[model samples]
Target: MSTVFASPSENGQTSGATGGASTSAASTPRRSAVAAVTNRLASPQTINFVDVPAQEYYSTNVFTKSVMKDRLPKSVYKSLVRTIDSGEKLDPEIADIVASAIKDWAMEKGATHYAHIFYPLTGATAEKHDSFLSPTADGSTLSEFSGKQLCQGEPDGSSFPSGGIRVTSQARGYTIWDVTSPAYILENPNGTTLCIPTAFVSWTGEALDKKTPVLRSMQALNKHAQRVLKVFGHTDGAFVASTAGPEQEYFLIDRNFYYARPDLLNAGRTLFGAKPPKGQEFDDHYFGAIPERVLAFMCEAERELFKLGIPVKTRHNEVAPGQFEVAPVFESANVAADHQQQMMLTLRKIAEKYGMACLLHEKPFAGVNGSGKHVNWSLGSSSQGNLLDPGDTPHDNAKFLVFCAAIIRAVYKHQDLMRAVVASAGNDHRLGANEAPPAIISIFLGDQLTDIFEQIKGGGANSSLPSGTLEVGVDVLPPLPKDAGDRNRTSPFAFTGNRFEFRAVGSNQSISGPLVAMNTIIAESVDFCAGRLEDALANDPDSLNSAVQSLLSEIVGECSAIIFNGDGYSEEWHREAAERGLLNLKTTADALPHLASPENTQMFAKYGVLSARELHSRLETYQEQYCMTVDVEANLAVNIARTMIFPAAIRYQNELASTCANLKVVGFEFDTETLDTVTALVKSLQDGIATLEYAIADDSAVAPEDACRHRCDAVLPSMLSLRETVDKLELIIADDIWPLPTYQEMLFIK
Candidate 1:
């Protein structure tokens, strides 16, 4: 059991973690110093991280003293580096030296305070700020940060969600330094603080933070991957690693509209908006010119990301009107997860500066394309490079084929686990909606590979595809360009050249959860293959190629059910998937329990990815998260329907009645049609609101999980019905009489 805090309720009681009511710099001299650094970067044209020289800045590698230069002795610096990079325990003797060095660096950069930054399972980072002011014996104040302070901090654990792991009375929790993620200085109008990334754990030692499990899972995969590499005679290898490049998609709405919508403010999604008249229908905004405001926000956000060592590589307008995407260059899974958390934080802060609110909620608006994070994954041996990439002669590369077949086998065997990885209350609205991949998990290998596989299964083709490659005078197209394989966007897990893109992951969800599942499952597959090869080599070293071929043949035959190279959104593919026996676990309730299934438990335990207790604990946690989310949304819908929509409709009805009476008294006969429409809509709104209220109350009367399902399937529908009637009222009601912003105003406002 790891001692990390898992949710917000676990640490909410912690004092000084939320930052002392955001103090301004005018109160202290340190604030003035920090402002100078921030002021320089505030100018848009002067901010440039792309050309920032690495020599004078902090390096990504933690084992070097370049980041802590001019602060510590040679011996103390090396000792701290060892503790940070090699997982060595921090020495007490070097504590003062290290602390003094950090304080000096931060002060030089104009920082006056510091905070222990930790991820507390609220799907975001948390920090309780503190000033660096300490009283000296002579009465003068001294800014101090001790070695112990740098390495550890205590945060009250009872307030964060511990999945019933601990009670409020037992609230002691500790934050330990996460040396892998570098500490950075954060500047604010109030003051500057050196934020150190740390892992939060409970007193009882159950894993509490998201990063802990991710780190553990990474270690698990590395061990198994190394074993597999050893079987392939890679003797010099110390590690085999996995990398991820997550393409994040999101929507940006004006902050004014965002503030006006209670649903968006409370739930991070709008539960009551009618579809915009021109919602992505014209196929515009996709890769269109970036809005000036959005462009400025992106520049600042990217600069912050770069300073923090997040390699953001690409940005573009997404499919929907307000939608956008940012893709980072590939990094190790652990670093990638850290960077993602930081990136979201940067986006939130910077978007505010541009008067926009970043919506990470999977379906912020109904009928518009929701967000998703396409996780591009690949594995490589320390000695062997990427095993997924085929060389020039792919047909003859048995190693690459074997690795590819292993992934196919893994995806086939644990398709449920893969589906469960991205299952969430928010994502339920996006999956199988034609914009994203279907709920059914299937691999899409392009046409060229499809043909190659078919040929291999059928004992190789008699006629081959162009035996020799050639150059062309018109070099717009590369000679042969490797096979022009057909692409499949429908499959949840698709092989795209050198890596597999897991497109089923939702944008707002943490990649660590899915990567943990992927790394564990793939490691299991790799272990299985290595075992078979080891035995075969021992039996007959002379027939190595034949053994490899036979192994791949068996894998391909068994895992063929998991492959589909057609449209995922098509009804035909769903039926075909059903016929081929694929599990379509659509909802979180349907998918989460599978994590505790006997087979999944065994597979995870086999590779030491997660113990059965840990797996069961997480399953329970996910179920709870799903239920709580639905319950909150259900409550929000009820409130909006009753308070916002119901009152708005009544006002409109009153206006209509007043107008009708005035016309009748004047002997000018008014149309009864509009009056009748208003009356009927009011009645419908009353009925639908009553229905929603009944469903919400009844759902609360049942088991928590059942209540959640009721909210999704029953309560949600009633809310939508009520919303539909109210929306009709909006279309008919005079613009001056309507209370809330209309869809057109909310969606089109810059």
Candidate 2:
């Protein structure tokens, strides 16, 4: 945390790598050897959590029937289990029994309080902690909870952002029981609390929360998926479910450094700083050794997540300095989203315990790799299972081919809608970047399947997927086998081994938005295919395979434009996509309006994913959110310029001018060139500020969209230019006068 600067000798050589007298005077007391060893042991290490026996992990890890069996009666336990697995309505009579069981289980785990956890439109989870205390008639107290309290909660809705759905005057909002997601105990520094996942809604109940729409979308998908499965000649089975494995990427900066930057604290990104002298250019940071501080945070985070029943599968260094990624195994979509939310909060709390701040911003630092949440999604049935799985005999698996073709068609036809799912003010900095996918949404089927789809289109037979060994070109390397195909990182939606990885979601966003769109779109396509096949079978009473083939053939033809097997980053692909009539929305403003488009409105309405009114309201909400974010950032830039940047520049200019004057008076010639350069730069910055100020004040004259565009695309660029000039001044100025922490200090601390 010390602002220690390197010193230089009179000969312009760096003073010997020893601490200067001034630096030594400023140093704090040294840590004990025991403390240092403790710090070293905190670094991340493999836990072999996945290798735990299934019987022990699955049976004892989570709140399963075995745990509930000892606490509740047979009837109540069965009812709760049915509700959790089958998505049935929660029976009010069973709430007290279930709550009591949960309370006992949590208390055994050292929990003293309970919280009703819910997801609001703020893009994060909200919870209110309350102690489980009930006063008795005597001088004693007994902890107790009633059926009504367990089933419902009334939290103050006035504080949460409602997107105009809930006005402040209407303070009534309800948190209804979402029995599908399991309740777990959150262990904190002070004490532990029972966290129950619930769906929040307003008095009017127009889907005022993220979880509500996700559940509704899941149901809509189930209805259509059931119809599709029925057409495939199946009945008397459980409903279809969607699964997601969201790979989370984030940055961990030392708490001392992060706290020093106002921009990081307020906006979750660095507003002004020159690029670091060394960045990710050499690509050495990827899979690099975990820094001691960051490693400790990750290890503790993983352990906590495991205890909460979140299966943390992978952890590694990412493509940039201070960037890291944590990926969990796939779970049902709703459960996965809930776990993701839980994981984020857990990461933050654990990071603080390690004296670090975990940044979930899409672009915390400019000129380095930005973070993205890769949503790996797929459909799985309760009985027949895995609709997207192309079996060993893929050509004969009519159901798989039909479902796969449905996803392609859905993505191709609704690329804009897909883009709309991940569009956000923060993510505008990531999409189309070197490390992130392009704004154009294209499906990467890999080389093997691209050829297969082409053959299917041309009425040709499927090719042999010959398995082969992959060898490294070095003698020391061992031979490795190759799979069906490789993935394309540049593609917005790429099909990995088992799931479609939607790579455009922002790090800070909830996975619910994108998965909802994906599930609904897939459901709609499946419904369309089912109706077609049912009609054909009824009319001809003949081959189901031929009927499915015809349906898939037509779908692939209509939506073939969205399929891209080559490099999506290449300019050639963009041009080809343009020619194929694909929609490429490069920014939040460009993509958000598509949410209310007639095509999207019709699709959602047909599938009952969202009503027309709800769709329009969401679009408006996003637009308003985008505008407000830009406004806040623009205002921050203005404040920094006026208070911090401008004053520092003027002080430096005065110092240079004084030095030149002193040299002239002392009968020695001094170059005034540096002084003149500083003067010119200051003038340019002043002019840029004036321009931004005028545009900001003219906001009343133009529309909100225009104003937002002016701020984001216009004023933002000008602000960057202004900062460039000021940053140059900082490099020349004395270190003592530089008020803000340098980029090196901010990025490299600890």
Give per-residue CA lDDT, model 1, range 1-750, as digits (tens).
111111112222211112122345322222222222122222234444457654334333222257665567888878776654444556778767777777777887778888888776666778877778898899999887888888788888767766656568888888877766677777676766788877787887666667777766666666666665665667764556678999999888765456667778788887766676798988788999987667877877876776677788899999988899999988877778877887888888887765567999899888889999999999775468787887655667777777788889989999889888798889989999989999999999876566667777877523334335556778697776445465677778888888999999999988888888888888788778877887898898776677777887788778888878888999998898889989988777777777778999997777666667657767767777886777687687777767766776777778778988999999988887887888898888778877877886775535545655666778767767877887777688666555555566656655
lDDT of 2 by residue, 1-750 (tens): 211111123223222222122333323111111122122223233345556643354323356566787888999988887776666777887777788878888878778788899988778789987778877899788887666777789887756766566667888899987888878877666888888889887787666678887888888778777777888778855767888999999998755455556677778887777776888898998998987667666766887787778888999999988899999998889999999999999999887766567999999888999999999998877787787877665666777777888889888778889999898889998998877999999999876667677778877436736447887799898888777787788888998866789999999999999988998888888778878988998988776767877787787778888888788778898899889888888888788878878988997777766778767767766777777776677677777777777777788889988988898998988888878887887887788678767756656525545655666677667667766776776676556555555666556655
lDDT of 1: 0.74
TM-score per candidate, chains pooled: 0.86, 0.90
RMSD of 2: 6.0
Q: What is the lDDT of residue 247 in candidate 2?
A: 97
Index of the highest-TM-score prediction: 2
- Count of backbone clashes for each model? 21, 0
Give the lDDT of residue 730 in candidate 2: 64
